[model samples]
Target: MNDRLLALKLFSRAGRVGNFSSAGRELGLSQPSASRLIAALEADVGAALFSRTTRAVTLTDAGATYLMRVEAILAALDEADHEARGTGELRGVVRVGTPISFALREIIPRLPAFMKQHPALKIELRVTDRYPDLVTEGIDVSIQFGALPDSSATARKLIRQPRILTASPDYLRERGTPAMPSDLAHHVVIISPAHPSPTFSFRKDGRVVSVRVDGQLAITINEGAIASAVVGLGIAASSESSARAELEAGELVRVLPDWDVGSMEVTAVFVSGKTIKPAARAFTDFLATELRN
Candidate 1:
């Protein structure tokens, strides 16, 4: 490989892994070699790319901006290479950010099929509820829900997942079924900390009714809330996709089948202006198709 291309590739890996040593390992180079390459690249670029510390290495602001452009250039080059070879094979790392609950309940289960389809692809799935910093983290793509915050990244709506109020049969039997939205005030509710308000809005009879629910437990994660609901802890408001298996298996039952708690919009987010990698594009397209169906 040419010195410039090699340096850029090393920089990309180092930015993604946040460690020169690990990046070097991935590129089959020693730590010292990786350091030297990155230093040479920085000298050429006339900027420090990383902030070094004892515990971790972090991308400098300039480095983050540069990485975005570098990624786009590399992606274009890869596409050219594929065209020249007359093959559309995808090969590279696709780092994806997604919510933990969604990954466990939806994506992870379907990942094996995707992996089989792209044998040359390396997937690094990072599960978290927090909004990911795409450039700094080197995340190729992210799956986000609900209202998207103002960002420079591009977002495309993938699916509108219906939200449902659910509770275990045992819990309903013990606590008594709630007949109206107002009755929820008397029942135990499992709330997501992400939604701090005690009130839940449901549409019924062409009107939206807001109900204030009380619960002894508040979960920070959707999986925790769903698990609590399944074990008869309290009623949980969750996306239909996440609770599909549990509901189908009779582990959890719908709380009010007639009312709607609004739908969660699932979006695929990617860095703006950066060329989307083939692996990322393929996986995202697969997700969109599968989820919409």
Candidate 2:
């Protein structure tokens, strides 16, 4: 609870949570004390740590850079403490970014078990559809879906789920199910921004076919696309995980049972560079295993 250590801890937590008040509460400090400490730390460093608005607090450019180094230091301290205590349990916070749908459907449901195993560790799970700037966002790791083209960061493929075309039972009854992939051209398709364009590819019996379809509705979120499809919007592309419940409830029916729309891959991108903290590494391993099951 020394001033310097307290400031570093507060700054790191604030940077991760994007809230001074919440971060302060976690550390058992009052909001006023947390603000004063951050201000003093910024003055000491000769830079503003956060840009404040009435609604939210975001890290400044300098703050983001400083957080990376500060987190490294904190992680090292956590490691030293673990060694000194002779316990293998992880400590400290590991910020993770995940797509909203997967986080809700797969990860969050299984998180309690993981937390039970490592009670000392903290997970800051950020849920969003957009591919985030990991370093700037202070994300230790990011669980992402689809293809990641940027080769700048370290990535590991966790699972690849088959993507399929699906439509609501009502929609199928009204528009008639397409007998062939080619027939999709005549039907309404729901475009997902996750895909590069309205073009979709299918594979059957060693023959690969690509089809370009148009839609009145375009959705960025996978869950939104599935929800739209559930309500009879149009034929939509969805992964098994995102649409499992609806598919089970008969709200959505497969458009073409035999054909495959390739597959969607979920990848874990680590932002801690060459050396990753133990807590972050453990969380990533847990996710990789749990997601596969």
Candidate 3:
């Protein structure tokens, strides 16, 4: 049965490529072997599946319909095989959606170790900053930052990422560091328009201060803001996770060490229904453990 299915799949590929030799090459079969298998299939089906031509092989009308049905059958068989495999063994693909910066700076570096541990599992990372529609986009799991809005998906808090007020050391040396939150108004501030307001809020010792800072450079994305700050564009606020490497290397320094720009919640969001794949759940669990540590 499996051999027959494999032959049907090869036949479908031949129909798509419109060449037996090319399709046979893809399936690790020689032209004569592929021709024999396809001939046997046609005999079994009682129909000519393809019309031979000097230039190309075209699927007959019956063959086109058969190709569609065979494709579905193969897909079903693949899914069934995946499901029959042990869930705890961690197989199949996990499609993860994450912020661009986090994916690049954090997750990507650690991915190799995780892949090593679960050699059977495949990972498909979809990096984006925008809030994705999980169901519509067919995402297995999403790493979301900040306060999650009302959603149907289950949310698990992975980490709390503090927003750090940062500036390149060169920029600070040139412009002079602000001693207080109010003094930031006098500096060239790189604002993220994604924030509800241009004002930055800080609280310490029962004191609350809000400074409305502006500058020539206003970046729309967090990663862009971090890059601009790294290049000494101006002072910008970024998540600690995004700026950790630069800060550790002394390329960037915190503008106000005592002040707080508040923290954002990094959550792992999974689909709402019962159909969540084991690979997706395992990957999310792995990420939560790795990221928190």
Best by TM-score: 1
lDDT of each: 0.86, 0.85, 0.81
Q: Stretches of candidate 3 above 4 Å error?
A: 1-87, 193-196
Residue-wise C-alpha lDDT for candidate 1, range 10-48, written one tens digit per residue: 898788779998888877889999999999999999999
lDDT of 3 by residue, 1-293 (tens): 46687688689778777888887886788999889989999999999999998888899999988987886676566567666774546665678999888899989999998898789887888888888877545577899888676577788888897888899989998999999999988888887623435788898888999988876787767789888999999887778878888899998999898887788788888766425566676777888899879
**Model 3: clashing residue pairs?**
none
- What TM-score, computed on C-alpha atoms, does each candidate reach? 0.86, 0.79, 0.70
Superposed Cα deviation of residue 141, candidate 2 (Å): 1.7
- Which sequence of candidate numbers ranks them by TM-score, best first? 1, 2, 3
Please tell me which model should have the higher TM-score, number 1 or number 3.
1
Decide which is better by TM-score, 2 or 3: 2
Off by over 4 Å in 1: 1-3, 12-30, 43-69, 193-196
Per-residue accuracy of model 2 over 63-179 as CA lDDT, tens digit each: 989988998898787668777867778777788999888888998999999999889888899889999978556677888888775777799889998888889999999989998
Cα deviation at 52, candidate 1, in Å, is: 6.9
Clashing residue pairs in all predictions, respectively, total 0, 0, 0
